[model samples]
Target: MVGGIAQDDARENRLIDLFNLHQAADRVRHGTDAILKLDNVEYEFELKSATTNKGGISTVRDLGPGHIAKWRGKHWIMAFFEGSKLLYCRYGSPDAMRPWITEKWDYIKADFEMAKYVPAHITLDTMFEIVGKKEVYTKADARKIHKNQMSAAQYETAQDTVEGYSPARMLDIFKDRARYVIERGSTLNNPHIPSKYFESWPEIRTNHAAKLRELVSTWRDAKP
Candidate 1:
């Protein structure tokens, strides 16, 4: 059920089978009496660029069938499991369905993205543990992260989550602060806000209102 593919993707290329596909077919046919035989199935293949010196890798996956759903302005695939047993799967956007693999498939010939689900147990698990061990942000670090102009990711994350202040409220606060900076374009007003907020606030050019509108709009619509 599970295998891998290597070598260039061309019809002339030969595949050295590490696992037996025919055997799996025989077992499923004889053992299940055709009940388990796949009538209509859908497969998704992915290709990804490798970061390593080697050109890249490929991956393949099979998802029997699934229904589609939409979330957050994008479509997603959804699959349901009955009490942890394997059910069926459907595909949508990343927001929707989670992917799974069958045991009989060959993975070596798969495209990079498809193969990504193949676990690199050592490296990936080590990295997972390493991430948890990293230092948590100090108060100063948190301030530093937010001090500059708000990044798109941060803005988007804030918008999607319920724990944070509402977007409208945050927008009002940012506009108020920006307006204050624009009005008091002199050194005397600089002392009021923390220096970290801006690299010594830029002098208010003639287009203060236009500039504020542009900046607010940019932050509002950005993706996380």
Candidate 2:
């Protein structure tokens, strides 16, 4: 019993050390050392009681990563870690993460609460279809956009040699537009997104950006 206790303590200490190292590295990478703090790290290493299946006649095992199990009449499970919090969204496979982050960040931000504006029946497959229709801009597109913006500088110089626009300034503007297009197109093409949630995309993105940044910062600062 004493040996078993010592082994468990050693494992716990190792995990803590690993988290500390991750937190330290994040601080340097994101320049969030000032605002981020490393707090106690806790994780659920086992599947929750509610997730398990046991019956008098038969016993079906709980699902692990990449494994499928039936839950609440649904066959699929989508799981991901938000900081140290392990979240499970039902009725979807693991591939749902991309669509979830791209199309449903606002919904997830509210802890999956069904509010007046939020859609209650939007399935993960629907989100995946929405994400699929949207074009993901490639590096080639970026280069083409940059080239067109730079060409405008030549036209400006010919029209007014003395007051010509700066190439760098034009490039900055074009880059911003490109980013906006990439961000906006995803949501704009999805007609099912609620107007209220769509309008709040900027706020949602900002909050998530900060949360992710802090999460990384803390993880890197961890001392494993």
Candidate 3:
């Protein structure tokens, strides 16, 4: 949701080109990266990148509450990766995803009250529950990942911008987190996820391999 073309821009841009989708002109916080015209309807998708090695946690860590609020009801297209190798991409609407995750907002508000703002995120364990962790990471058919390394100029602008900021203080800023939970998906709940949602998916939840086969069944016909 960052406005500028950051390190992940390379990956986002490539996806737009590869899919024959138009790139959004003005990239901003809580904004989309690509556009599509299907059946005379305009569709805007918020693209996200997750490293397979990192438990599908987003490469971009700036998904705050407001950003997420703006993201609701929009289509999500996430590309998985291992190092610089791009894996499969997945698409789903909010309705299709609602059952899989639970949102926690109370602790998020408390954190802000204490002068610390935690980022918000959707629970992805449901994705793992529907498919499996291995299915998302292990299979790379042919395509390699597109790397989007940030330019030096943006780094310079962001560096030590805080007043009276010392190198040590800057290091601390990177290390610090709120006393309350910062991970919205990881908060404690009466009924835990993956477990609660597990019983619902009888077809592929237990047989994770079926999830991969299922993707092939509905595979889209296109060229890279």
Candidate 4:
């Protein structure tokens, strides 16, 4: 799904070199210095006080000659820091954040178990899809789906005779009825969506719609 270099090994090597140059015994002790916080583990030697001591920052020194994970033909260094209260940081473009930041930590810690299965972009896409799709449906299928989903009392009131009204017109009226119910926070049989549907709603719908759009584009491109 991704299109580009996932990781640049030469860049990673330079980062490790820089870190060793500044943090290792070679440099003079001075004021607080900032590092380029790369996609590697930093091992911090615990001192007497946690606050006083800068937390352990691991450098990719050992793996200087090893290969990292490759995704979509692009190289990415995949590492894990093992210690107490570990903090993983990545400095670069948004792509660097995808494997961990956006995907791993967006939700609750308990959600991490689910995170193993769900990627960040997927979750984000789901959210975007649902919102976009809801808007699309509101303009497109809302009235029809609303009519189909409504109940007896609602349908009775909704059936006021309109001469020469097309199905599309009827649907629009039904959707308006549903929208009114939603705005008023009224309870009705056959509500437009179930309780849980409201939680993710349009985002999931929107991503699916986008996937469809992409597929259509692909099909058109493939056409002879």
Candidate 5:
């Protein structure tokens, strides 16, 4: 019975160690807000909704849950917590709590760093000057931008795909096609684009290039 109990304890310790390692990795990747230590935590405040004015400035009111408000030199900053750290993303205005709604969380979390406290958490209707209009890029514009950004081979693959070339002929072609639409620009509304490319496009587009490469490698290896 004692030996069995010892084994159980060892197993429990191993699990705990694994959990800690996982948490450490998460902290490294996602950052932390350390809510308990308000003084040490820098918080961002955002409104639950937006209202626009004649100048095309948008104002946000009401704080989203877990969003903290803090005052800087001349402006009110609102932000949300990811784990224990303030979420890092680009804000459109001085008073905006959340980053632009369109930004991917994975991209935002890449900016996490060591925890430090700035004043956070204020529950009130605060007025902020909206910075400017959010730039609206059409699907075509996005594609053109992507074309400009692609390598010579990637650009060739994209042009070929648009012209109804099947990327299935080669793994490099397939991968390049995927990067053209998914990474360089969105693939929305292009009927000629392959169904297979779209199947994993959403996932591949959001991930880093290394991840996309791994996915492409797996798909290539599976191909007969």
Candidate 6:
């Protein structure tokens, strides 16, 4: 069942079907892709597929989802793939994933300005008009505009969902969303607690392999 797949996304869907995981009813935008139940308890999970060229390294596009999930005090699964080829998945409480997430967050944040920003999505003509130029908007002018745009875009587009997922936009929205989640999830009596915790990465990986093997063999033989 996994001989050759066209795309990583297709392989993700196939993995879901193979495992009989209940897909999320709607897009958990900037969140995990689907749900998995083990022992009558459901777990939300994000599926990721990275190219095999990096010696089996997968990547996360945005730390937003992981941050939001952790702030909400939810334990989740993270599955990895190289096309149709499955890889080890992590199943842990947020407490367990926190150190890694923090490390990654720090790494990504190293390039961040942590300042105000204003985004201008205007045409070159408008830009030239603003600069009061009749003709070419030279490279020098563009450089000035770029600097202004990068610093101000965050403030202007914090809640702008329709904004494109540029790095600036993502930083703006994710920071805002993560902040809100943290405040909403906290209380005087109730503190962050992760349930359904499992820390054995090896066990999760082994189970997935065996389950997929049996599933693929049975599904292929049963195919018309």
How many residue pairs collide in each prediction? 29, 22, 1, 16, 15, 7
TM-score of 5: 0.18
Q: How accurate is candidate 6 locally (lDDT)?
A: 0.45
**lDDT of residue 75 for candidate 4:** 14
What TM-score do all the candidates reach, one by one? 0.14, 0.17, 0.43, 0.15, 0.18, 0.41
lDDT of 2 by residue, 1-90 (tens): 697446434433333232232223443321211122334532112111111121111112221111111222111111223433333212
RMSD of each: 29.9, 21.5, 18.9, 23.5, 26.7, 14.3
Pairs that collide in candidate 6 are: 116-151, 117-151, 117-152, 117-153, 118-152, 118-153, 119-153
Residue 102 of model 3 has an lDDT of 25
131-159: candidate 3 lDDT, tens digit per residue: 33332231121011111222445333434
Query: How would you encode candidate 6's per-residue C-alpha lDDT over 62-149 as one tens digit per residue?
Result: 3443454444444444455565576755544445556655655454442232311212233444433454543333333333443433
lDDT for each residue of candidate 1 in 1-224, tens digit (9 for 90 to 100): 22212312211011101100112245321121111111242212111212122221222222111111111222111222233332332222222212212211122224322323322222423432432322232222322334545565555454423444333334333443343343223112111111132222232233433443343334334638
Q: Which candidate would rank higher by TM-score, 5 or 6?
A: 6
Candidate 5 lDDT, tens digit per residue, 1-224? 69744643343233223222112234321133111112243222221111111122222232121112231211121122233332321121222212322232233232221011111221111101111111332234334334455565654554434443332222233233334343323211211212221222223222222442343345335647
Report the number of the highest-lDDT candidate.
6
- Global CA lDDT of candidate 5, please? 0.27
lDDT: which is higher, 3 or 5? 3
Per-residue accuracy of model 4 over 99-153 as CA lDDT, tens digit each: 4322222323333233333332243234334333332223223334454565655
Window of ten residues with lowest summed lDDT in model 1:
11-20
Q: List the residue pairs that clash in candidate 3.
A: 86-145
Which one wins by lDDT: 2 or 6? Answer: 6
Q: What is the C-alpha local distance difference test score of candidate 3?
A: 0.44
Candidate 6 has its poorest 10 consecutive residues by lDDT at 187-196
